[model samples]
Every structure is written in structure tokens, then in C-alpha cells.
Target: MQLRLPTSIPEVQECLADGAVPIGGATLVWAAWQRDGFPELAVSLRELPEANTIGAEELGAAVVLHQIDDRVPEVLHRAAAGVGTGAVRRAATVGGNLVGSTLRCLLPAAVVLDARAVVLEPEGHFETDLSDVLAKHHLLVGLRWSAPIISGYRKLDAEAGGPPPFVVASALHADDGGNRLRVAVRDGYEVLSGTVACAEDSADVLDTLHRTDLGTLDPTAWETVRRHVTELLTRSVGG
Candidate 1:
């Protein structure tokens, strides 16, 4: 296995063009390392061009999940801090999370925030809404998230040992004008994606997403959970 570190977008572009896989913290890749065999070339972005520019405001506030120790205190950040345990969250990155599709909870948040993904493909760079990225299995280079006046994320877990989210939901109301909502269902490898309930459209955007399912929950129990979350988000967002 070979490793290279580049410090500019052009260098990254060249690396990707050479078929090297970009590596952030290597958590996700290492998790499946033996399964797919070690990467022929692992390009570390730690000192290279930073992709966490995707922010909470102007999509420039994105900090790698590990970089959230004391900078941001939002509940979402806290939740991200605890995802997959202390060590993993500290080493796993938001970019890796998306690229590997390891955590479903993050997807709903990206969807609700109307997050956009900037993929440094071998041919050229392209951007796609995070919602669309989550719907497919792709090699994600980085992500961009526009700011939100009000944003929140929610997830439910099973007996507490489930590896991934069962149902996840996120909502964001941007002062820019339009509001956003998203809900996603995950079961092992099968994922279900959907929009919010229409009746709650005008309500606080938060309420719209609360109707979604986020967590490692069983589908049989998703309906009841979904209803409760809907009512709760509705009351909070004044829907």
C-alpha cells in the first residue's frame, strides 16, 4: 500500500485521476479494509486540501466530526460527537461518513439542510445535493451544506447494539426562503428514502422533518415512532 499527501485541489485532482482513493481518517475504509483489500494508493487529506469547508452557514461551517470537540455546541454537533462511540467519532470524518454511507443518521441531516456534495471525480468536479448522493452508492470526495436558521437531527436505536441507523430524520429552515425536510429508513443494507407529510408543510420546517424516521429502529415499529416524532416536532416548530 502506498500513501501520498497533497495540499491543493489540483494535487487532489491529479491523485484521484491516478485512481488513488482519498482517505480522511481511514475509519470507514479500515473497517472494511480486509473485505476489499488495502487501497493501492491512500491519499490522506489531513494536510492536503481541506474539504470540511462545507459549513453550517454558507455551507462553510462544516468541521470534520472529529473536529467538533469544542468549536460547535449545537445538539446536532453533540449527536455527531457521540456517533459510533468516542474513538470512532473522533477519527471518522463527515466526508468519510458520506462516502462510505456508514451512518444513515447523517444522511437525513444533510438532506434536511439541503446539503450539496462536491465530488472530485477523475474527469472533473461536480456537485450533487446530499439527498441525491445518499440515494446512491458513490465515491464522495466532499460535502457542502448551506446555513440554516433552525436545524435539528433525530435518530432511534434498537437494543443499543445496532451498527447503523434504523430510521433517521432531519429538518432545516433556511432564512433564504424555502424550507427543507427529509426522512430516511435503513435496515442493514436496504435503505428507504421519503419526503415529509404534506399536511405539515407550513409548520416550522423542523416539524416537517420530525415526521421522518431516524435511528436503528425496526420497521414494524417505525409507524408508531414516526407519529410520535411528528407530533413532537409539530409542537416544537408550532406546526
Candidate 2:
């Protein structure tokens, strides 16, 4: 119905407060929203400079996958590179990947990276743990994460061949005590995460996966999910 393209965060917030739905690249829209019909009032984040942050530690919501660089993390780069065709990569935004009804592989990488989200809420803008922003359904503006000592990613393609793949990403970040292991798994439904103090805490990140949350997974889906997670764990510890 109606579309508002705001160039500033305040303007974007205003549009949102006025009941406008936030839109990024709209690539995910065709897959998840087309059948339901589009929202009546929508605001585009594309024109805002803040939504274009592609630096090493920060990634704006509207940042396209093509703009991602090696500086962010190898896991992120590999996941972004495997998402879709070159044209899709050129148009898909990180926000779209994370906020869509499901997800594009990138969400798992963001989770493992322990990324924090910068968001615009009704009260004002604020930064919080990425999981909090996601759980509360806030409008994400950008993401920030530190470089990890080691990072890795793996994806299991959809057999039907069109849907986004199941992905698992891992990162080992240094802490005062030691390097901590962060692992995330993304099925077709959502992204999930877990961690261990170090590689010795557990041989695998299998505990991170909550199968019951997946509802009904046929043997095929479960195996693929398990397979990727195992692959990431293997790579993470050099097994």
C-alpha cells in the first residue's frame, strides 16, 4: 500500500511509530510475505547512511551481502558467499536475512559471533545483546562484534534446491580466562545458539541444538541439521 523511504534514523523511527513496517532489500518479502499480501504502511531503510555500515566490527541492517569483507570474520564471509546467486547477493541485506519469518544462513554466523544489535525502539534507540533485540522483535539498525581467534561455518543445501540452506557457524573468542566457544545452528525455521568455556568443555556443540523446538523434523531434516553442526564442531577444534 503506502511506502515511506526515510533518510535519517529519527525519520525512520517516526515512520515506524506511525505504524509503518520496516523494509530492507525486500528480497525475503517475496518468499515469506507475498502470499499474505504486503503490509499497508512500510518504511525503507535503504537510504539511511547508518544502515550502510560495513566496517569490520559493525554491520548495518541494510548492508548488502556483497559489501561484506574478510575483515568481519571468515565465517561470515563464507556464509554470505554461499547464500545465493551473485545477483541475489548484490541485493540481499543483512536485516532482511535476519528478520524474515525464517532466515538466510547469515543469522547463525551472527549468533556465533556474539553480535550485538543497534536498534530503534519506540522510546528511543539503544544497543543490546543481539539475542535480546531478536527476542523482543525490535527494529534492528546494525550489528557489532569483535574479531574472534578462530571462526568457521558449514551449510547443508536444501534438497528441493531453492530454499536457504541449513547452516552452522562457530567462533572462538578470547576471554580473560581462556578462549570461549560459541556455536550456532540454523534450520529452516530459526537460528539457535549455545557455548562452552573452551574446546575441552565438550567434544561437540550438540547440546546447543534443541530438537524439540524444531517441532516436527523428519529423519532427513534432523540428519542434515546434525550433520552440519558436527561439521562445524569438527572444523572449530581441528578434528
Instruction: Identify the candidate with maximal lDDT.
Output: 2
Candidate 2 segments exceeding 4 Å error = 30-40, 161-164, 188-190, 199-239
Prediction 1 TM-score vs. true: 0.70
lDDT of 2: 0.75
Top TM-score model: 2
Q: What would the per-residue lDDT of candidate 1 be over residues 46-154, giving only the tens digit for each residue? A: 6544455533432221246756543322434645654676787777766666656455445545555555676555567678766566566444656555554444445
Given candidate 1, what's the lDDT at residue 82?
49
TM-score of each: 0.70, 0.77
What pairs collide in candidate 2?
none
lDDT of 2 by residue, 151-181 (tens): 8887775766575566767787888877676
Off by over 4 Å in 1: 31-37, 58-63, 69-79, 131-139, 160-165, 174-181, 185-193, 196-239
